[model samples]
Every structure is written in structure tokens, then in C-alpha cells.
Target: MDFNMIAARGLVLLGCGKMGSAMLGGWLRQGLAPGAVWVLDPHPSDWLVAQGVHLNADLPARPAVVLIAVKPQMMGAALPTLAAMGGGDTLFITVAAGTTIATYERILGAATPVVRAMPNTPAAIGKGITAICGNAAAGAGDLDTAEGLLAVLGQVVRLEGEHQMDAVTALSGSGPGYVFHLIEALAAAGQAEGLPADMAMTLAKATVAGAGALAEVADEPPAKLRENVTSPGGTTQAGLKVLMDPDTGFAPLLRRAVKAAADRGRELGQ
Candidate 1:
């Protein structure tokens, strides 16, 4: 939460899309001077324009950090804009998926401190979890700085190595989508059981949201929490019988889903 260093040195944001704006909002709320931030976005939002930040302005020569929040497809076209500021103390932190540290080092200089982060879409609401890993050129101080900035979005976890990022991407990065799909399916099932469509959807949404909130604050593990709800031969047990089936249940299904996602991530990184 200490903004003295970042405030004094200035911070450059390469893109000001949803994720970028979310992080920016968090920073500003935490008392960061808007003048200290210089954002470079081709299509800046009206909200971004109204924030009083230096939008599309000339960046500082040695800014404290240059956060890349552009899409992975746009990275090749966007990164070179900040090439001049690379290979120095300015730490480069990228939330762009599938872009590797080696690619950044090759483009921005091997000496540039780079941190790769995978943050989910929930970051737009400051309720996401982000996993970060730094390249060899990045030092402890650089990681600390990156973690501090990203913490504004949500919880931040440090990875032991960059290789773990793929699994992290599969699990937490794409997890929100999986949960959304679960909500859709649950609502559909309820409708098939004679509930009205709108009522089913509302019930499904609240059920999932309440369960997730409980999981977040609960002291016991999720399995234990589930056990607390299931009776020997009650309706919850009947539902668990299908969901926890040995051959065709959530465990195997989710394993395959996560593996497919991780495989695709590895392929994209290649």
C-alpha cells in the first residue's frame, strides 16, 4: 500500500481497457496521484478520460513500472511503444495471457525485470485472484513492487516458477467462466424440473453466489462444508450420488476441463 516510490517515479500503463481501468481505479482510490500515472491507450474510455490521469501522454524516461494490460493478440503491436524505457529499473508487469518472459526479454532487452501475471475477468470488479511470477532478471524488490500494485485488484499469490503459470491459468484464470457455465446449467436443470425460467435463474444465481461467499469465509474445507449439508438418504445425498459418481462425476469432468485449458495455454505460449 506504500505508493511513495511509485508516486515519485511515476507509472506508465500501456493499455486502459477494463482490466487496466480497474487497476487504475484501485490505485487512485488508494491515494495515488493521478498526475503520477501516464496511460497509453488507442481507444480510451470516457471514464478513463475523466479520471484526470495523463492519458496518451509522453511517458516518463524512467517510470517506476510499465503495466501491460493489452490483449495477447495486440501485444506484438503495442509493446514496441515502450521499447525506449526497457532494460532499466522500470519493472515491466504484463497481465496479457500467453505472452512469455522470454518474448518480453527478447523485445525489451534481457536485463529488463519482467513479471508475468494471470488475472481473471473478475478483476474488473476488484474481486479477482492473480498469480504472478518474475523472470530471472527480476529481483525480490521488483516482485514486491508488482505484488503491491496487483494487490489492489484482489488477492495476489507468488508462483514458485513461471512454468506453474499454465496450471494457474487453467484453474483460476478460466475458473470464472466455468462457474458461470455451472450457473447456466443449474438454472436449466431447475427449469426442466418445472420451475419457471426466470425464477430458476434467480435461484441458481443466488445459490452459487451464496455458496461461493460461504466458501470464502468458512474455516473448514469445502468437502467438510458439503458433508455438513448431506444426510444419509436425503435429497442432498441423492444429488451428491450423481455429482460424486466414480466414473462420470465432477471430479473427472473438471480434470479433463482443466487439462484441456492448460494444454491450450501451453500451445498458445508456444
Candidate 2:
């Protein structure tokens, strides 16, 4: 939350899409000066233009930080623009999935302090959790700076090493999509059991949301929470019987899913 260094030295943002806009909004709300921020985007949104930031203009010779939020496909073209700012004290933080620290070091210089982060879609609402890892050029203070900025979106965690990033990408990065699909499937099952379509969807959404909130605040682990909810001979137990089956349950299925996603992440990084 300390804006002393960044406010004086300035910060440059490479892309201003949904995730970028969300972070920019949080920063501005948390007292970061508008004049200290510069945004570069091919198609600037009306809201972005109204934010009073230096849009598509010249960048500061040495910014405190440069956040790269462009998609992976757009990164090749978008990154070179800031190559001039590399190989110095300026820190670069990237949220683009599948882009590795080595790639940035290759484009920028190896001396560039690059921090790679993976944040999910929930960041749009300030509820996402991001995992970050920095290259050798980034010092302890640099990691602290990156974590401080990223905390505006939600919780920020540090990886032991870059190798763990692929698993993190599989678990939390893509987990939101799996949760969304569960809502859809739950609603369909409710409809199959004779509930009205609208009512089924409403119930499904509320149940998932409520459970997640409970899990967040509860002291007990998730397994204990599940045990607390289901009585021995109740309908919940009957449902759990099918869902907990070792061969064909959520456990094995999700393992395969996460493995597939992690494998793909490794491939993309390569």
C-alpha cells in the first residue's frame, strides 16, 4: 500500500483489458496518483480514457514498476515496446499465463528483474488469489514490491520456485471454470429431480456460493466441514455414496483434469 516510490518514479501498464482495468481501479482507489500511471493499449476503453492516466503517450525513462497484462498471444508484439526500460532497477511484473521468466529475460535483458504471476478471472471482483515467482535478477525487495501491488486484487502467495508455477496454474488458475461447470451440472440435476428451471439455478448458485464462503471462514478443514454437514443416514449421505466412489468419483476425475491442465501449462511454457 506504500505508494511513495511508485508515485514518484511512476508505473507503466502494458495492457488495459479486464484484469488490467481491475488492478488499475484498485490502485487508484488505494491512493495511487493518476498522473503516476501510464497505460498502453491498442484500443483504449471509454472508462480507461476517463481515468486521467497518460494513455499511449511516452513512458518515463525509469519507472518503479512495469506491469505486463497482455494476453500470451499478444505478448510477442506488445513486450518489445518496453525493452528499452530493461536491464536496470526497473521491475517488471507479468500476469500473462504460459509466459515464463526466461522469455521476458530474452526479450528484455537477462539483468531485468522479472516477476511472473498467475491470477484468475475472480480478480475482476477483487477476490482472486495470485501465485508469483521472480527470476534471479529480482531481489527480496523486488518481490515485496510485486506482492504489495498484487495484493490489491486479493490474496497473493509466493512460490518456492518457478517449477511449482505449473501446478499452481492447474489448481487455482483454472479452478474457477471447474466450479462454474459444477454449478451448471448441479442445476441440471435439480431440474431432473422436478424443480423448476429458474428455481433450480437459483438454488444451485446459492448453495455453491454459501459453501465457499463458509469454507473460507471456518476453522475446520474442508473434509471436516463435509462430515459436519452430512448425517449418517440422511439424503446427503446417500448422495455422497455415489460422489465418493473411489473409481468413478470427483477425486479421480479432478486429479485427471488437473493433471491434464498442468501438462498443458508445461507445454505452453516450453
Candidate 3:
């Protein structure tokens, strides 16, 4: 797909909150012009206003890509406004959780290309993983278009099917909270082991960050990397014994949490 084509076609970002602003920043960081983006927000930001980007309360034009970043609950109100703008050729890329492609088809018509994506809060820092899926109407170029738009924020992977979107939502979408809790747990453990509170927190944060970076860039499997660090009767092994216990450790808790999130996502789609 020619990603260069999307920039030439123009784009509209509906809603400009934290995630929206982050996506905009990522695009600008990747060299997309501020003029190529038309923003629609009820409350415009001072910085966005100063960038020469349009910030109207209503739809201004029919764009090649109409990114839906508003809260899912606002879909009913927003859809009509977008439809009125005549987004016939627009590829609808919705970041709102559980808003299925069927909903977009119902509101915008079946011919419109719709892509559903799950992007985590990490995208705010340009280190996110986005899962993308699209409908039958999406052509080869449409997938490229959606992927290119999402790639502006972070890594993009196309899901096998839209059903997997719920799982993606459960994993990467809600995964940041789980990682945050793990960092907190590690910090508390450090404090218990006699480290100063401030130092413990600093260590935990850096350790988590470094570990994540290693996992991302490493060619070895995570288990192998983990085993390489664990020595016979070492302190790390002793801690791992508790964390890796099958009946009561991290796995069961994380599995339950992901299931709960997936179930809630399914419910939200209905």
C-alpha cells in the first residue's frame, strides 16, 4: 500500500482529547503536515489552534480518512454529523472500544470502508501496539490506508478477524494497567527488602522499562531470556518460585483479568 497516498488525500480527526492529541503528535512526528489534518473538537486546544489546523465543532469536509476517536457512548450523536459530511470515500477508523464495523455500516451505509482498531494508552508516548481489523468492503489499499494511519502512533498488526478485536482489547488495550500494577508490586517488594521508598520506586520503574525494551528488541524467546537471568538458588529464582506457582500465581490472575475484559468488550459491542 502506498502510505504516501493518505497524506495526499487529507484526513480528519474527530475528537481531540488525550488519545486524539497523542495520535496527532505522532503523525506530526512522522512528518505529516499540520495542514493535512482537520480536527473537529468541541473544545479546541490552544496549541492545536496555533498550528493552523481547523477546529470546528461540526464536520467540515469529506476526508479520505475520518478517524473516530470520541468515546463510544458519543457515537449516536457523532455518526449523524459525520454522515451529513458525506464520507462516501472516507475510510472510517474507529478507536472507540467495542464499536463494531457493523455499527458503522448501519450508520454510514455498507459501502463505506470501516476499520476497527484497539490502541492502548502507550500510544501517547509513541510506544503502543495497535490491533487493526476491517470489513469486506475494505480493499487492499484500504487496509494500507488504515494501517498507515495507525502506524503513525505505533506498531500496527492486522488481526485475523474482527472477533479477535475483543481479545486485543483485553490484552494490549487493558495491558498497561496490569503492567502498572506489576511495577507497584515490585516497588513494594523492594521497600520490604530494605530499600528506601524513593529508591525502590525508581528502581522498579527503570527495571520494568528496561525489561520491556529487552523483550521488544530481543531475538530470544521471553522464557529463554528469563531463564538466562535465573541462576541455581539465586534470589531472582526464589522470587520467581512464588510468581510462577501454577495454582495461585500471576498466570491465573492475568487469565481471569483478560477474560473479564474480553467479556466486557463483547457486552459493550451489543
Candidate 4:
């Protein structure tokens, strides 16, 4: 999407940490006006200051958008300063997890247009996916604007309702941790089979990375890909027998794990 309009209008970012910096870098790369952006953070990065962004300065009388990239815990401190900006034409988008759209409305105003987003760890490297939901006050244009801004980070998926965000948080928000653990487990298993420690780790990391890249470009489903790799009685098939067990396989384990994460997200919302 053309970002010329977004670049022209002023934008205020509430944080300038890793994820926020990654997002800002992408926007600048995509033609956002450096002079039109303002960043607010207690500890501003040298890189951010070098990029020509207004750092810790008095905000514009009214920015076109206010993006909250602070931690969920820092919401109290960062949001109070911008509460007045809400309930107006200026849209508010947040990447803070476990903070619902209702909470922002309560702090800002019932009519505030708030968009809550959940982005994963991969966002730090521009490989993540984000799920977003806007409050009742948000319209098609508002959501479109939010998506355009977030598309810089990675793939963007819009949710049907705010409630679905919990499922999204469970799946992708915490998914990187699960994938990292899988890498560790694979390395440990390889070590048990007598592969050297460093070699096992290298193999585990490369295997997972390669597989994910393949899946991203593959034309067929994962099941089809798996079948193509498994010979009549090969090592891949032997591993599949253990991993595909209906009762004890990855399905049941991942189901419980994701449910727990979703439940925790709901609890945090309260």
C-alpha cells in the first residue's frame, strides 16, 4: 500500500525499544517522513536519535496516530500522558499484550478509537505475524490505517472480534518460545545419540530454520510435505510413528499448551 499519506501526517510512538525500533526502521524504509514522526521513551536509543525522529519532545498539538509500544506494565505511566489525545480523530494503536481495547477506552473515553495488537518475538527481526482488533469506535478506515502501519513489522492478520485476540496470543504471541524449546529438545536428542554438543545444536538450528523457510514457499500442506520425505520404512517414518500417536503426539500436547496460554491471557485481561 502507498504510504505517502501516512508519511505526511505526524505520528507519535510511545516507545523506542527493540520491537518499536524495528517498526520505526521499517516505516522509514517504506517512505515515512522522518520529520513527521515523534518517539517518546524514558531511555531513547542512540540509533533512534540519529534517525531524525523527535525524541522526548513536546508532542504535536494533534498527531494523526498515537502508537503505544510500551510494555503492558508501563501502560499506566505512558498512557496517562496521551489520554487527552483519545476520543478524537487521532487513532490510537497499541502493541502491548494483555491490555484490552476496553481498558484504553476507560482511560481515554468511551468514544476513543483504540486498536489492540499482539505481535510476537519474531517481529524484532521482521519475520513475525501480528493479530489486531479495534474497538467499537473504530471504522474501516481506522483499521486499514492500523494495518498499514503494522504491515511494516511483518504479516498482519485482522481479527473478527476482540475476543479472538486471546487465541491469537496463545498461538503466535507465545509461539516463538515453543519453537525455541523444540530446537533445544532436538539438540538434546541428537546429543543423546552421541553427536557432539556444538554439532547437534548447529544441526537442530539449521533443520528448523530450513524447514520453516521451505514451508513458507511450499505449494502443498505440511502433511503432503511430510509424506514426500518419509520413505517406506525410513528414519523419517520411524520418527513420525512416535510423533503422530493420536493419544501422545504433538496434537494433544500443543492443544493443552495453547489452551493454557489462552486462559492466562483472559486472566490477565481481567
Q: Name the candidate that leads on lDDT.
A: 2
Per-residue C-alpha lDDT of model 2 across residues 68-136, encoded as one tens digit per residue: 999899998998889999999999999999999999999899999999999988989999999999999
CA lDDT of 2 in candidate 2?
A: 96
lDDT of 1 by residue, 66-109 (tens): 99999888999998878988888889999998999999998899
Clash count for each candidate, listed in order shown:
0, 0, 0, 0
Q: List the RMSD of every prediction in angstroms.
A: 0.7, 0.7, 1.9, 1.1
What TM-scores do the predictions have? 0.99, 0.99, 0.93, 0.97
Model 3 segments more than 4 A misplaced = 1-4, 7-9, 57-61, 85-87
lDDT of all predictions, in order shown? 0.94, 0.95, 0.84, 0.90
TM-score of 3: 0.93
Better of 1 and 2 by lDDT: 2
> Any idea what lDDT model 3 has?
0.84
Which of the two, 1 or 3, has more lDDT? 1
